[model samples]
Target: MNVSNATIEDVLNRLTNQTKLYFQRDNNTISVTATSPSTAQASPGQNKTVSGLITDATGEPIIGANIVEKGTTNGTVTDVDGNFTLQVSGNAVLQVSYIGYLAQEINTTDRTTIDITLAEDTQALDEVIVVGYGTARRSDLTGSISSVQGADLTSRSTQMLSTALQGQVAGVQVTRNSGGPGAQGTIRIRGVTTLSNNDPLVIVDGVPSSLNDVIAADVETMTVLKDAASAAIYGSRAAAGVILITTKRAKDRQFSFDYNYEYGIDRPTTRPTNGDVIDWMNVQNEVKWNDGASDPYSQYSQETIGSWLTNHAVDPYHYPNTDWMNLLLKKSTSHEQHMLSVTGGTEKLRTKSTFNYQKGDGYYESKSYERIAGRVNNDYLVNDWLRTNIDLDFSKSNAISPSQINPISHAYLASPYYPVQWEDGRYADTKDGENPLAALRLGGTNRQNYYKFGGKAQIDLTPLEGLTLTAIYAPRFAFTKGKKFTRAVPLYYENGSMTYMAAHRTTNLEETRND
Candidate 1:
């Protein structure tokens, strides 16, 4: 067993002379078979199974390694213990591959059991990464840059690209300014640089565009330009930083279709839940007494205080203690999104088309946002000398909000002792008090619609090898329309009936902006 100087011939001769065994040469190894004085085996079309363990050079199990027959789709991946079971025809060759490892092809002739060790592919370590104007190998980069793939973006439950970017990159700060649905998050690269708008310049497919216009599912990659050296090409607008977003495109001469739907709910982390009616009355009385007010019960009688504590809906609307926050704000708001895309190509032409729709409700009633967007991109090669590209995108968005006051702020500040409405179904009002519930009921709506459209065309003429002519033209248009209407609301009440004595006022406004 310890014969170190023995040759292959000696070993084979000893094995043949000692036992009824025969050896044959595999690619780089030895295969052993028993010598039987009987009939030969059957044909190669019969079904058989091949099982083994795949590992690395260090003999550690390589989970999820792909094992398949040579020229077909029959394949299986390794299990947790690097064990694989593959069913194939007799004497089939097995091809194995894993990420970051070199692939191997093993011959399965007259052998059903074997182990494989794949060497690490060192060349992949210097893989090329996309940059601002082009690409560079990771080892050849001198500036700071971060890249994220589209698959990572689509996995998040977000309506806009900005919100999905949170925590996805280093040296980037992303924050949601408010808890309003469909609100875009604020992003600062390498911190703020100025007192004015410190937003980074966003470049979509080589044109300046807003993140709201680009759907998360339509993005192919996002690259952040962090340092001055990496952003200098963009001038003043790039003082903070720059973001380059590339949309998806057809990669080969095959057709593909994708559909994705996401539905979720958003709720406020904390709501303004002050004390109940009885607790509120008691605390107000204590405050009045502490401030040297003589008559603590001057505002209401003991009977009224007991009625408030009992919460008897006797008159239904006359004497009520309304939980304004609960009445005005919903516990959770619904959100939904849908996206569809088609991609196909030939060697001469390639096309990708996408459509996306989104709708979400705000925390407050009657507050919501809706949007629909579509994009189409095409590229054509008119022989090897000339090529052309076309990209078109359009989006329409509508938002609705309360005209007068934000419901959340009113819910926290207004008193909750008064009823939202009177017995005759009239809006409740007080002379000196502002009813949050009344404000919600009487306030009008402000609506705004945004229309964005952009298109670009480029042609390349490769007349010579190192010198070529290029022509490009891009046009963008945006229009916004807003409408607001307000009506005079009773300010306050006297006695049991409403009694605010003010002149009725009405106003109508319409605004339009274009760029």
Candidate 2:
């Protein structure tokens, strides 16, 4: 109380006991300001060292748990003993996370030591799964069933829905029927059951369907019933297995618009390796000599072989050492997908709609696939006792491939000495009359077009508690059109003259199916 004889420092210290204040002296001019409790406890820009131990809910030390300062990249991981020390700024927050465990955040204000216990993430086990004719929680199901989310399927960037299921579900083996664009894979659930068809029966939105008729982006969840007990509802039809596909639907009283686009490049994992023309000529001569020929270079003279080796580099077009695989197949093919979704409605009526377009190029020329698909789902609640639902989906796809022969096989067998094209841009002849480049570029196309339209409608009436009557009507229509055309490809000499017709043949076929 008697500050007249005390210095400024002593006076301030005595006054701080009764009321917290901040004082600043500028060359003997003293200024004081009132301060809050929090400001008096910690100063700005001050840092302190904090240490913590992380453990699981059962009090077991959790090794390798990550601890990070909130809003900063400064972070550290727990040691083998589950202990971590970190330097953090005043009033800093620490975020602790680990796999299969819930994350925790702790404030380090007025504290030097902290301990955390993480809880197990039971979200996956508590998820609701669609089974046979109804839905049940995963923990409640005893049968062998696996579920894959729609997001997981789309992340793989596969064109066919069957291809997206590869390696995602346990005990489910998916093998591609072909490498061409828009090709579907064979899905064998629990291995082969019969000698005939091993294809699993696919059900989309409670209706029998094909995987090709569904789009990955439009799926909500995929459930596979592996054992007979889980798929007994379908009887003998589920002999192989049963796959249930649920499409996305609108939520009540929510409005959202989403657009997604993906672009990717597909490259062959391996390519055929061929030697240069000189090596090929030497091998040919050796083969003839081994076959008891008097002159090894009878067909390919030594002088001609030497001329090719000398001029091949200078005049590659005429005396070319062609790599037929590289010439026929592109380095990389491109594929893209576009999706637009709209979801909006009131409490009484909800609706969801999606439109998708996908285009992909094959590794070989004259090979590609394109598809356009659209879906609409609507739910209406007439009253608490009555409800109605409707779903509509349509897709059109076109696949173009080389007709008649397999160009990839031909490329492996074709000679490396022949030029892909002569100086005059005419196809050159091969030893086997199978010029892969000519077949890829000049060959006719085999085109297949598929169109599908499907609709599902349902009505429900509830007359009493826990008692409801339901009726459903589902109809699907599919049409497929295929056309194959093959024509002759002429082989020309180096001087731009037609040497001979390279096994040319004319064939035309067209087929159409509706179901």
Candidate 3:
């Protein structure tokens, strides 16, 4: 160390510490080697802090903002104060967004709180679709199945499934036979099948079934499996595709109920007219060859026939009890339907049950239908990983007396002079008139009874998040029994001889089961 003349290095050494070094080489200038406090500021590294007063494009403070990091699991929704703090990493991009505003991204390199204004994302995600056994984005589906969800059915005003599908599905047609309750609905998809009977197979929960299987309000969805690939799995009876019905499931903590109603008028078809041309030629032609030779109608004198045409107009035995056609017909018929359902579940058990009633009156004599149907579905969530389910469907339907007619030939065989009369004061049974009212009364009264009871149960073990193991059992029974009685009605032999009359009874039953 030079002490003479106060050399630069000697003076600098006294002032600078070991940590700070200051030196002069040729006694010309001094150099300093040390960290500048301004350049050595502390950093959070991967962690980021964003601080900015959110505001609208007009700079007014936005009350609440939601900020999320682009690709990681970090996200923070803004508070009511419209301010937010986001902690993110170095390589991370901070996403600032809100319900009404568009999203904005800023790199967290060296900034603290970045005040940002966001624009709304007008193009939101499309509707979420519920597909078979799973939910899909819709665009990714390559199959021919169509899913009809609960929300879609809830918006309709019909009581039955048949009414709901009308005018709703392309290539699917639903025809309601009449306006009365218990009226049957016919459905045809695409067109009639040719190779075999083309009727579609219906599956409820996994078992074959139909609209008769449950109330509309108790149903969750109806899926149409249209193509071979989706339907082939059901086999022999599935040529016409498949209708899969999913019944409402029990909720874990709430009891729910619903009701639906529809009221309308029954419009009918017009009746026949043209009352004049009875003439004489047509009746004569229809006479049986053996009897035609005898001119059976001419057997009645001209005066008698003239009297029948004016005053005894509607009779076969000098009585006005016959119009043949009118006796065999009916006027307008009407109906009503009501349905009730309740569904709910607890942590350990759940249930869904429904009751439905329908009544229909036909425009024809004694033609009517009445149905009473009930259903019960129960599920027990046995434990965290096990569950059991049960489904029951029962119904009774009956068709009332309606008119019977052979409109084609009734106009030809009856003689205007011969009157319609019965020994019992009821319209008599004549070869021509046939006494339609008598046939309904004494010819044979028919009573038919139909009953069906069906049920299914399954146990499920869900060991994984989305996988389930299932076992099922099913049993069903149906019966139709008819009783008829016809007292001594005449049976004529070919030789014009009368033979003995007869009475009979018919009955049948069907029962099925699966395990």
Candidate with maximal lDDT: 2
The list of candidate 2 runs beyond 4 A from truth reads 1-122, 269-272, 289-307, 313-318, 493-503, 507-515
TM-score of every candidate relative to the true structure: 0.73, 0.77, 0.57
Local error of candidate 2 at 80, Å? 16
- What lDDT, from 0 to 1, does candidate 2 have? 0.85
Sorted by lDDT (best first), the order is 2, 1, 3
Comparing 2 and 3 on TM-score, the stronger one: 2
lDDT of 2 by residue, 359-442 (tens): 999888888999999999999999999999999999999999987657777667777877777776777876546576776666
Q: Give per-residue CA lDDT, model 1, range 346-424, as digits (tens).
A: 9999999999999999988768989999999999989888999899999999988876767887667656666676655
**Lowest summed-lDDT stretch of 10 residues in model 3?**
500-509
TM-score of 2: 0.77
Q: For all candidates, what are the clash counts? A: 4, 0, 24
Report the C-alpha displacement of residue 475, candidate 3, in angstroms. Answer: 2.7
Please give the range of 10 consecutive residues that has the lowest summed lDDT in model 1: 499-508
lDDT of each: 0.80, 0.85, 0.60
Instruction: Report the C-alpha lDDT of model 3 over 358-384, residue by residue, as the tens digit.
Output: 766555444566777888889888788
Per-model root-mean-square deviation over C-alphas: 9.4, 6.9, 19.4
